[model samples]
Target: MCRWLVYAGSAIRPEELLYKVDHSLIDQSMHSKLGATTLNGDGFGMGWYDGPRPPGLFRGIGPAWGDRNLRELSEHLESPLFFAHIRASTGSPVQESNCHPFRYRDWLWMHNGEIHGFHQIKRELVLAIEPELFPHLEGSTDSELMFYLALSYGLRDDPIAGVARMVGHVERVAAAHDIRDPMQMTIATSDGEHVWVFRYSTQHQSRSLFYSRRIEALRELYPDNANFRRLSEQTRIIVSEPLGDLPGAWHEVPESACGLVDPGRDFLQDFHPEPV
Candidate 1:
């Protein structure tokens, strides 16, 4: 599994989330305490949405903590919504193209889990992607392939439903190949407007995924904390783990669920897979 974070709300420097927190995304890349692995140095990538523009992406093929370019960019780039991920490869090669926050047009996606026995079902899954979208496939990692599968199933119109279909498709294909416990995922996907995250797996025990408590709530819980003062009411950070140990600053997203951090109120709802 990998580690990832999604920031939606005010336009702020990426470094605040990527480097300034207690267990910042960059810090997690090197010393993760709750991930499947402690070191997620295979690669890293970030994609952010700015006003009225297509998202911008920066990916590198090494430890995120040591990437000078990643650090430099994080310090200067600010956006209202962004995704940052540090990867730990399951079986894929460590190439830049295989980095998370994979892009297609205005959308950005990243995931922290894998499709069990991907090699066995890769051909069928790849062939299922829409013809127009399949040509855009650029890497061999199941993570990227999964993103395209969701898109193929209408992710641009509805995130949760599209993903449900994608997961359903994967499980059906895996079952046909007799692969048990066929998938595990904690995913984030966006089209520069709405950010949707899902935590699900065939085994019902997905992974560590959490969203921040409302800033208003955090302000009351930690009255003197300056970090809470700067955020807008809509500001929400969806991370793989808590960045700090603040008592009520973070809430674990329930297993087999989906979260949407929107421009208005956010939502946490049950997610169930459906046939594609």
Candidate 2:
């Protein structure tokens, strides 16, 4: 599994989220306390939306902590929405194409888990993708394939439902191959505006996921903190784990839940697989 985070709120340098926090994403890449792997040094990537243009991506086939390019870019680039992921390869090659935060036009996606026995169902899953979209598939990781699958099922129309449909298809095919517990994922997808995050697994014990508490409340608690003061009240972050140690700073996303972070609201609802 990998570790990732999505930030949707006021435009700010990516470093504010990637490096400023106590247990920042960079820190997690080195010594993750809750991730499946303590060292996610296989690779790293970031995707951010600037204006009306398609989201920009910066992926590297090296540890995030030591990448000077990643450090420089994070300090300079600013966007209202962004995704950062540090990978720990399960079986895929450690190359730029296999990195997280895969993009399609205006959308960006990252995942922190895998589809069990993907090789057993790869052919069927790949064939299910819309032909036009299939040509755009550029990576071999199950994470990227999952992103394209969501797009094929209408992610552009309804992200939550589209992802649910994708999951359903993978599980359906896995079951046909006599595989049990076919899926495990903590996924984040954004269309340059709203961000949708999902946590689910066939075994019902998904990976860790948490979202920050409302910024206003954090401000009230730490009035003197410059970090909280700089952030807008609408800021919401969905991360693989808590970025800081502040009490009430993070809330665990429920098992089998879909979390939506829109303009000024964040909410959760039950998530169930649905056939496309």
| Shift in Å, residue 206, candidate 2 | 0.4
Worst lDDT run of 10 residues, candidate 2, spans 258-267
Error in Å for residue 115 of model 2: 0.4
lDDT of 2: 0.92
Model 2 has how many clashing residue pairs? Answer: 0
Shift in Å, residue 20, candidate 1: 1.0
- State the RMSD for candidate 1: 0.8
- Residues 202-271 of candidate 2 have per-residue lDDT tens digits of 9999999999888999998888888889888889988898887888888899999998888657789999
lDDT of 1 by residue, 1-276 (tens): 799999998889999988998889988988899999999999999999887888999999889999999889988888989999999999999998999889999999999999999999999999999999988999989999999999999899888999999999999999999999988999999988888999999999898999998889989998898878988989999999889677778889999999888867689999999986
TM-scores, one per candidate:
0.98, 0.98
Number of the predicted model whose lDDT against the real structure is largest: 2
Model 1 misplacement above 4 A: none
Error of 1 at 195 (Å): 0.6
| Candidate lDDT values, in order | 0.92, 0.92
lDDT of 1: 0.92
